[model samples]
Target: MTIRLRLAALCAAALVLTGCGAVITSPDQVTPEVYVEQPSVSPAAAKRFGDDKAEQAYQEVTKFALEQAFPEAFLDPAKKTYTAAELTAGVAPHLTPTAAQGWSSLVTLALAGDADAQDSLRILQFYNVDDPGSELPPDGDVLVRQQITDATVDVEEPSGDSPERLLVSFRHEAVLAYAEAGRPYELDVTKTMSYWLAPAGANAGSTWLIASYDGRMDVAVDS
Candidate 1:
């Protein structure tokens, strides 16, 4: 069988063995419970932004990190396990298959309601850079700083008695960091991602949903 076919089969087998139910379920079913509400920012602090839009943007930013960025970063083998090339060549296919074996492990994870898988999907759906810069970090000790500079949203007005719909645009900045061996270094990276919240209707709750998220890093250095 071709690589694509083999990958697909593996995915299908995994799904069956894991009892994930469906290969392409909606996001609502997969999202964790923690992302349902706005994050806390003190009223006095929030007033510095001076607008409801800013408040909404802040909420969306935190929500994206928790519900989308964290999960994607955790489960993505390119980011976590394999190199980027291996991911493209060895694991890119198998989203669908003619036989039961055609499902990929990522698909299985996604269908199985794995929180990490859900987060990965959320990040791809929401966070993207128009021009992704170089992946390599600079040589020598250096600290990187990143921040979000701008954002915008298009909200659809609710009909008769429905909730609003939302479309968002976000932007950010990043600074590279480099350090010598046996030296301590700190780097801070900020990201901004947008989201589209469909109007709340009878079937709306069944649509893509993100409830909450927590971000943590497990760091290990290899010699």
Candidate 2:
């Protein structure tokens, strides 16, 4: 994997494998993986700015994270039902077999209309808007911005010594979304998200995806 950066996201590109956990089978009986291509590192990279494998892994991971971070598919005002294929598109790629095992198990429950998944979706409502068109896509959806305050890449030891994880991180302000009044809604002016990525396998060509994430957005505001 290689490390590359973009305007916030557009990270993970294409990879050979799919599914972070288990194969997701929707009630509609359409396998999400069919519409998705194999996971690969994202393109239009930062241009030889960082380690190849780590940057590539970061691209792969952040792209998926930004996609899933959106509250759109899950919190549309129409209460639109996200097809398993669409809902699972950005997440499935770039997952390691080990991560996929646990991921699939949890996502399977979510796809099955599980309460937990529903609850997870509910949390994203704060980012939701009845009208997405209120703001331009670029302004509302700056996945990778020039605002990264800090970044670091760590390549794990091979030979199964240190779990062979590729960790990349970015410390940046949280990008918020637009709401009904046509104004940007930033809940926390001081909040920032710390992103982390890990490789899906031990080999040099092993793909990457977000294995862990930690951030905070606790601001006193009226939503």
Q: What C-alpha lDDT do the candidate models reach, one value each? A: 0.32, 0.39
Weakest lDDT window of 10 consecutive positions for candidate 1 = 1-10
lDDT of 1 by residue, 1-223 (tens): 1111001112233332111112221225443223223334334434543346445555544343333332332332224233333322321221112211322344446546655543343233221211122122334322222233344544445568434534444443233242334343333333444443432225432322222111222222221
lDDT of 2 at 61: 46
lDDT of 2 by residue, 1-223 (tens): 2112112111122211111223222324343321112222223222322457655665554444444554344433444345555545555455455444444554455557665443333221123333444443334442221123344555434454334444455443333433445554432222234334554555524465554333433333224
- Provide C-alpha RMSD values for all models, in order: 16.3, 14.0
- The per-candidate count of clashes, in order, stands at 14, 27
Supply the global lDDT for candidate 1: 0.32
In model 1, which runs have C-alpha deviations exceeding 4 angstroms?
1-54, 66-143, 157-164, 176-193, 198-223
Candidate 2 backbone clash number = 27
